[model samples]
Target: MRKLIPLLLLVVHHFASAQTKDERVKIDSILSVYTGRSVDGKGLLQEAITLSQQSDDYLLGQLYFKLAEEHLATGAYDSAGKYYPLSLTPLEIAGDSTLLGEAYIGMGYVLYLKGDYTQSLNYNLKAEKIFRAAKANKLLGRALKRMAGVFIAMKDYGTSEKYLSEALTIAEEEFDTINIVRTLNTLSVIYDETGDFKKVDPILKRAIALAEAIHCIRCMAISYSQWGISLHFRGQYKEAIGKYRKEYELNKLEGLTFDQYFVYQNIAEAYFELQNLTLALAYSDSAMFLAKTENAPQFIHDSYKIQYKIYKAQNNLGKALAALEMKSQYVDTLFSQEKARMQEDMKVAYETEKKEQLITLLEKENTIKVLEAEQSKQLRLYLIVVVVLLVLAAGVLFSRYRLKQRTAKLLDAKNIDLQNLNQVKDRLFAIISHDLKSPLSSFHTVTSTLNQYYGQISQADIKKYLEKLEVASKSLEDQMKNLLEWSLHQISERKLSPEVFDLKEMAETLKSFFQLSLEVKRQNMYLEIEGSIPLETDREYVQTILRNLISNAIKFTPPEGTIWLRAKTAGAEIVIEIEDTGIGIASEDFSKLFTLEADKKSIGNSPEKGTGLGLVLVKEMIEKMGGTISLASELNKGTTFTLKMTGKQQKQAA
Candidate 1:
């Protein structure tokens, strides 16, 4: 035994020396990657993990922890979760509290992404406790920051801000530039969400400077992005674009494809707000391309939405419809993904419950065995009955809890539907009462005036009265048509039946239909057609759209004002424009023009009244035909309604 002890000591010493040497080499390699001296971070970490398996538990735990952190940084949450737990056992065996806490922190982040806020908080709190005891200020700050993130997700912004403030203080004290920048960004987000815009800018500015000082490209990019968002929210679009461009440059420099995609979207939005549609379209296309390359459905959907807005702004109705279709496709994909995730969560919960129930049964069986040996038969029987009763009670309570939760969800959805229906009902009634009644009363009054003064009135006066009657009747007719079409649209009863139609013929029809109204208003109507333009769309919808637009032009234009109906063929689409020299719309009202929310009425140059439904109906019909409409106007100058739709001739050409 004494001879064996000496031999074992020699073996132990050799193993210890080898472990120390391997650990040193592995750690150095990891540090090289982390410090940017090497580019193969993931590869090196994985190799380190493989090599450290035969080393001491402490070294192995550290390698596993580093790999998990690498996964976390890259957003591979499931892999990070797996490795984080793997790290914990070895770290516990080695009694390394610091690395164990780090594993807990990483696990907390994974749980947070999985929407397990309670578990995430528990893990973070455990990490915080360990770090506090160890006086690891840097690690403690990270744990606190993670806890703040959980509170942020829970929407406890006040509490999140408090935690973030403590984290920032610790980071500052330790001169941890990375943590300082991160905490500042998180703090700025809280302030931004709480509508304290005043504080966001300064914090983000400081964060950006610190990140720049540290030469942290990613950190600087994040700060710039946040600063751009702050400016965007404050309506400083030009400055926002500038900041987003800076972010784009930094992300591009770092080859951060995903980050560049988001930066492109931000720049597009800022340009869109500034009315720079060309640049907006360019940036949006870039974002869409990146989104497609990444195959990220959510990013694709968002990019399509941005493109839709840009196309709508440019009056490219065909492209806008295509963008909307793409957006809708991605929306459906996202919904399915969410549903699958929810089902997965449910499956996980069911498995957990089954395991728990099995554990309870085993525990009860052991308790019964003990009781049978140590107690009387009657006491053992009583314990068995009590345990069974408790199990039944728990089952019943769980069933009730699930039922209540389902009931609440159903009630909330139904309530939302009811509220939406009510809003539609109210708006419908307002349109009918105000718009329909005004024109009908005017028609009635004009006819009665003519009947009562027929004999007393002169021929010229009678002619003038007839013109007034004609105008009133026409206005009433258009209003009734719009109201009926809009009602059909509301109930989703409208369907498109596309047929080939001549654009010139449609223009002539509209001109004839609005001839009397235009003459009454003394507006010169011009028809400009480029060759033979054939549009493939629902004829009635096209006619209705044109009629309403021409009617608006006549109504808003002054006496002797000019109205032009222009149609031209552009590749596979026909572009139509209804231009009028009239009192133009204000830019502020442009957003509300095509929506049902445009309730405020505007009187035209002839003091003609409008229900604001004409443009709304026009817009809906345009979209129904897979087309787009856009408006350009300068107050008191003129307004142009531009429409674009696919042309049948192009299909023939192809």
Candidate 2:
């Protein structure tokens, strides 16, 4: 019976192992969809997460880890933080040491981003231990590299260098091109920051070569950006701008919005160094815009400082002072002492209130004692006085207690308000930064080119350059006008003026406005109207909406892609759809497509510049005019935006 039992158990173990292998294949298939394309897979991800939960398998941990990675990529740190622990729990329970190590690495990344370097390091160290025990060199290199970043952040450069060197050695041995590129770039940064400029370029060159060999756009971008920084450090402003522009173009192709600010700011600084104040100012504006979108206080601060320099160089004292003021305000936000002072004052007030209350009670007690001594024969009178004093004291104490509670509540509310204000400030900064960049970049490119080629060029070439400059200047002017209108709409509540206008005529006007942009991309647009479907809506608001929508379509749609503006009337509604064969939005982005709360920006097919505030404004205007907006998109396929508004004057129907 015992021998039979042992045989049966062995058979069950073999079956379970086979079952796990089968499960892994299925899980891997699902994971491929996530890792393969830039499509919206939030729904698929959630469904997979549900299936993982139901199965109660080791795949649950992997699903959680992938979800966490997705969140981390999107800068959703809180969501990433929540999922990392779930990953760790299941991996540990299943005794999957390999995945368990990855979970630690995931947690470490989340904590690092949250600015908890010590805790992040702990997680990375735990991951290192697991990877080392399993002899997983690939993952061990990643953990070691992450640990290097933690140490760098903690200012232990020696330890960081050591870890980085170890990671580099492992990456080389494993022939891990990606890790090799990463390690090399990081080492270059460390050396550059430490003023070992001689060593930086060679390291960056190697990183770039490796990155290029693998066709890794992100790694190449990083290397080029670092190269620009090294040049900027040495006052080689023109060369630095060249490198920075290279980085910017690569990042744009990859739609890496988060990293663009650094390149933009570096370009601005380069122009500033060259004493090309106009171009410097423009690039500074661009940098500030990108920085604001990211809510990166440091970048915003740097941008303002550059702006101040530009203005000062141009002898624009007023603008320089304004820039200085703006820079100072951001500095205050970055390192504000006001909250600490407020807390200290509150503490002092509470203590003083308590002391005052105690002193009052003691005074009352002394008064009662005196009365009792003086009125020994008049015991009733003394008792009456004592009772009155006791009642008054009780009333005062109750009032003070209520007041203190209110004070505490008020302080708590104020703190919450302050936190919310900081968030708003960050978003507002992003918006301002974004709006300032497009026109600025356009202006800078033109002016810089003209300055470079002016006297040395033929008259014909000069004329061409002048014409380009004129076009750029006009574009900048239009951008400024749009900025003014946007600012006015946001700053005050204005009544909308609705009128019956020729929808076809309005479309023609918009077509003219975006003609240059369309020609640039060689995109085709067709306006298809079943009838003259004119509506009574705010003319300016409708124009704004149509302008932004059409512009966006043109921006996103690749060269030779088609766009259709179709409108029809159904029941009491005029339905309009802007359809584009464009690089469509990912499904995960749908939730915030029209939300002003999200600083959502993506590069267009033109690699065009946009603040992302336009869509937000469009939604607000539509809602105000009692209209609805909806979108249908398939990534790399197409996007369709549908707008429905109440039909105006049924009697005047075409």
Candidate 3:
């Protein structure tokens, strides 16, 4: 039994080692799934981190390294920063210099995302030394490329180009298609920024071809994004939008959230440049939505800025102000983030300095004083930033106040114009009423006198009364002509001139004449002239019909309702329709409408009394003009009057 015990221990120890190896394999499998872009790296890494913490394994460093990279790829800089150092701890403990160097590269990327170019450069330099020590040429090239990106972001074009040129050489020698294409895209961007557009397209083209040849979606997305940027810089906004759309579609299909966010941001800018405010705002919202999820403060800031611009372009000042406020919030957040990062770095420096000074008793006393000075400096800087943001916010609010004041003044001017129009309408109506009443009253008196004295008088007296009636009738006719001329300028003094006229123009004229009436009722009028309308009847008759139809529409229509004057050409006939969203005629009133019966009277919505003779007159006139008129109405709904007239109708009558 004692001899078998050693065998059992040996077996158990072997199984434990095998189990650890299997766990490591599982971790690598999970990482492979994430790196292959099959699933979200951040989620899978979180699970891996949990499992790694539960077990002591040699793969822990690699897991932490991959987790940090996932965070970096998602633009979670702070999280990446934390994870990168954690990764370095396990790698250093395991004596894996290769992974430790990779962790440094990840940290460099985090710092780059945080906008600390100098610190990122320092980290990249350290990574380069580690890679060179391990004789990893490809990795060394990667570090160089990263340094170039930092320089590009810093606007040090010469230094960026120098680094990129070296990286490209290494990438070509190593047959690294990804890095080769990426470096080309980056160089294109630098050239584009330098306004060397002529040099930009060729470089981008090469990158695109290589990326396509390699079937690398990420490379293609990067090249397409840079191409879009170059086109955008050249003022080809629509073309840029097309390129950006390709990038967006590719990134979406690949589930690359960061790439999609960048594409959306670029698309927003392109649309904004094209003066397409709606599309710009839509893309900006998408960018903001993605940026929020990724914790990408810079992209979030950019999204708000684009939204603000779009709102301003649309003349939506209130919304623009709101967007501006949001932009300011993000700006403040980014500033705080940068400030906090700087403070963290300084604290690290202070701690390192304190440790070094403690080794030398002479420098230890001054270390506390130095820390106090740094802390005081940071406090003053925070106060200054707060005050500056407050002042900026005050400026934005004051601009909003000024905009409101201008809007109020503009509204006041519009009101004055409306009041003047109303006054003109009143005066015109007064003149029309007086002219009509005088002629009407004279005709009535003459007829009444003749009727009463006919039996008592002789034939000569009757003839004299008849002559007086004739003069009164002529006078009434002249006054009616004047009124018609004043109301309808289309009416000629000699005779009714019927000719083909633009139906839209006639409708427009009618709309203008009834503009005041429409305004008074708070109603809207629309003209829907489908095509050319050539009427065969007299223009005066058409005008009179329309005037009566429009006046009745206004009187019957309630406040905030609509009236439509529509005309369309139907083969040999021109069909005109006047529709009103108003209180409609009753079923019984339909029969009485065209008849001169005692019941043919209606009080409109405004209590406007009418003899209902308009429709009767219209029907008679339509028949005389060789045309037809029809009416459709519903109770409390609306009314539609349609007229079918043709040039052939007049020819047939002739």
Best by TM-score: 1
Residue ranges of candidate 1 with Cα displaced over 4 Å: 1-64, 252-258, 293-297, 312-317, 328-654
Candidate 3: deviation at residue 383, Å? 51
Q: How do the residues 1-654 of candidate 2 rate in per-residue lDDT, one tens digit apiece?
A: 233333432322433445445655666677777762236554456557643432443676777777777767765565566567656755765678998898899889878986889889899999999999999999999999999988877768889999999999999999999999999888876776566889988898899999989999998998899899888877788888999999999999999986888787778778877888778778778888888987877678778877866776675655765776687577666544434544554464355447645654654565556556665655554455445445644754564455457446755775675576556556555665776676677678868887897778888887776776765665555444444345435533245665788777788788888887788679898889875667676787788889879977986888999989888888988888999999988887887767666645543234555556777777877876778999999889889999999865222111
lDDT of 3 by residue, 587-642 (tens): 66677777544454353244544445466567766766678998899889999999
User: Which sections of candidate 2 miss by over 4 Å?
Assistant: 1-33, 36-38, 249-261, 287-305, 312-654
Rank ordering of all candidates by TM-score, starting from the highest: 1, 2, 3
How high is the lDDT of residue 263 in model 1?
88
Give one clash count per candidate, in the order shown: 1, 7, 0
Model 3's C-alpha root-mean-square deviation from the true structure amounts to 25.5
Error of 3 at 102 (Å): 1.0
Give candidate 3 misplaced runs (Cα > 4 Å): 1-60, 248-265, 276-304, 325-654
Q: Rate the local accuracy (lDDT) of all candidates.
A: 0.77, 0.73, 0.70
Kindly indicate the candidate among 1 and 2 with the higher TM-score.
1
Error of 3 at 234 (Å): 4.0
- Model 2, backbone clash pairs (residues 3+ apart or across chains), number: 7
RMSD of each: 18.7, 29.9, 25.5
